[model samples]
Target: MTINRLISGALSITAALSLGFAGATVATFTAAAPAEAASTAGGQITRSEVLARAQFWVDDHVQYNLTRRSNTLHNDVEGAHKYGPDCSGLVSMAWHITANAGKGGNSTDDFESWSGKEYLGSLHDLKPGDAILKSGHMELFAGWKVPSDHGQGAWTYSLNGGPDPDGDGWQDDWAKGPTPNWKGKRGDETWSGLQAYRPIRYKNIVDDPPPQSPPAPVYQTLGDFDGDGKKDIAGIAGDGLWIHRNTSTPGNFSTSGVFISNGWRTVNKFMAGDFDNDGKDDILGMNYGDELMIWRSTSDANSFSFQAYKSLGTTWGNMNKVMPLADYDGDGKLDFAGIADDGLWIHRNTSTPGNFSTSGVFVSNGWRTVTRFINTDFDGDGKADIIGFNGGDELMMWRSTSTATTFSFEPYKSLGPTWSYMNKLLPLADYDGDGKKDISGIADDGLWIHRNTSTPGNFSTNGVFISNGWRTVSKFIGADFDGDGKDDIIGFNGGDELMIWRSTSDANTFSFAPYKSLGTSWGNFGYKILTSAPTD
Candidate 1:
């Protein structure tokens, strides 16, 4: 789960509350009528009412006070009161306890054991109007949105400040919506260690439903959709391409929004690049029938009005084996290359968007024998090189010998044989801030990154970066997602979610430290490919 750093303050409070003495007395509350029993009597509270009550304080800027201490101008129960209730007090008021003058003077621990509540156990089981309890602090779980590649979707909450709404000074009002990082003195706490609970019956509250799961994606891709320097995610479902824009925050993407819904339904194996040399990324799509097409961007990265499709001539009979390579000719244009049963073929872009020379086999002898290959600038040269893995798991490299048309490859250099377990090999930029590019892959064991030693084409296997929890990942893409010059890893699980592991290490080593779940069901998208626009 990606912890929303913005809500860390609230989490800190929960942590503090959790440390409170266990001997504190638990509070007791009157058991109200059940929803079925009170529906006709108008005693059941609608979810909207509870939300509205919470929103009121936020809207009016109610002051915060821990002791329910009243000032002359602002009284505890009066609307004009300068200071509102503390964390527990706000929750108590929202529940309309009616006892303690509706202030709900229960301690944080008291709320955990309150007579009329039920333990939810897991945060996934939380619903609207539930209370999140730690020893020193408590917050209302208003609701949740579908999970995303960034983590569990937004978990809405209603909380009061120990001081101000921003958690800065004293006397803050209601904070409605997703919990923001409490900016107060103790902002380092997190909800990863807290407990959640819900009231069986409270005043007019009848139903508290759990959050709905996010829709499954049909296809996914990574690119700088908005040209914000941070890589964003674009997913396809049904006929629509949903763009989850990067928020410029590490591991976070904006809520999914529809980018295109008409012509993308049947698209498969999509790739992006500056095909026109227009400096904006254009899309190339291949249909199930192996019909190749290009969707040229009209203006910028954010605008994709692919009004007309340019046919790239359908000679892709071996479409399933095709791989989109970077500028293979160093001509400032992207090219299409693939391995065929016959040989490795290259369709060199003729310095024109959507135009390619006739498909020709580049490496005829050994191409058909290789199991996997990826393109990257391995020798600090501007030209892209091909790294391949053979069926026997022997890794080799084909350094580019031609920087122009009529491409050629140097003799293969053996790079060891340790990738037998890897299912996918992805090219990542300098991860350790080292000048050399590194290689990452996904296997049954999860994600493994092999740091490149300063020696050209040489990698260090002694101390490799490995993440075991990523066993469920089926596919992965790499990009400098945070605009930090360091490449980050994004992957799709077999299920509906996408996750990101930001790079934190400055040396050749790597540390995922925390993995952010983008959201669920992204695997529904058939296959995903990632490409970025050319930067001039």
Candidate 2:
């Protein structure tokens, strides 16, 4: 038989200034809560702060004690409070929920009682910083070692920290020795009997920081919307998104379908990214209302479009000429940037996936003049950077700094009267399969390709003609319509037709395999814009 010596409610903690656990030397500690943090009676909290507070114990090696023992009393973290040194106390302190003057946190029974409305479907739906509880023990959810798998088991943060973390063992006190509690997980043996584990979230847990000064946003990169592992041609027209799936043979479109058909026509442009971290491309764009919105993608192909959505922000209308999409902070969360009247403005994403705050600004000025703006990791620093071209025929790059919260401008090159007519810049895949971004631009005369160098922002080859005699095309997008690793070029020619000129060679040279029409009379679908989902 198993037993868990759980603590009851309203623990009467003594201010043992010198008396430590098991007769040690440390005092009972109580950390001051964060400013504006909620009390134990239940107020709102951010997922980040909850996880942050949990780490503090692991860092200080707070020992687990069944007796009415407090951690410490300091205002370093929040609300000027402290928590008990037990399982429920650890979670309650992590959640900033302690009743009766912060003497002790909630009990196992308290957590179990709260799980009725807080259960998030099941353990599979749990994200980081959530908790799983049974009668006598509870654990802070870290994640699954395999990202997509949940039933296998889970990694957790518990008060006992390690060894008998899953049991109600008579744990050793701090006087004996503190065990590391930060990086710990439960295997099958523990998880099987832990079937009563109730998945619960704090009542006030927000995806990002509380509504206040929003942090600078991070850019959301693109993804493969169709899950084909290859880029597909997608466009926004009227209220629906039209996707033309490319065949194994280039320029041959296999199918046309619509995913998102709600409120898309209100968007001036649409950009694709994995906003929910579900590993699929989600369509997002700012409407005239200034709201930063997202339509989450799912695993289902037939029912994936326009299923879930969120209007995360309302102040984004100020970012005019907006293409604010990229991961500027390397934090794995998508960031936002756009050219406002003053200059280029950026917002670093300080929240979780699919959530954002627009009040923050990374860079406030000095980028309005950049005409041809596009993003690529020119420095190959794992963070995407921006390259720009202007009527001056000069090429430049705005590099993401080491911090990734902002950028620095660097001049790249200039051609005297040569690329003066270069109106559009297309930085596509590694045409030579060399693992570097190949520079491709479109002129009124034809398409031009340049080989990027090993050095940052430097091109080794001159502008070579990929094709000629096609001045009817107005805009172009690069995507691998087929499941090929190589990216193919899709163009909107004559203002009404979508055409694909397939790549024929793998050498430094780019030749076409004849033009194929993907669609015609596309203008009938209203003012349309195009995007291609990326594999990475």
Candidate 1 lDDT, 1-536, residue by residue in tens:
01122123222222112323244432111112122211221234545445444444443345455654444112222242232356666566555454344333555666666664566546666556666666677766554333221122324444545435554445544444442333322112134333333323343466644445321110112555444455556656667666665665554544444456456767776776656654445667777666777776554444545537777767675734665456666666666777767577777776454343434546555577775656665765555677767777888778766656587877887877767767766655556655556777777667777776634444343336577876677667766566565677777766677777777867745876476777776765546444532100
Stretches off by above 4 angstroms in model 2 are 1-223, 245-253, 259-262, 351-359, 404-417, 427-429, 456-461, 525-527, 532-536
What tens-digit string does per-residue lDDT give for candidate 2 at 17-109? 321235333422222223443333356666655655655565455666675544343221344566667777777776766453355767787
Each model's Cα RMSD = 19.0, 15.3
User: Model 1 off-target regions past 4 Å?
Assistant: 1-221, 250-256, 299-303, 318-320, 352-363, 423-429, 454-463, 528-536
Model 1 Cα shift for residue 367 (angstroms)? 1.2
- Per-candidate TM vs. native? 0.53, 0.53
Best by lDDT: 2
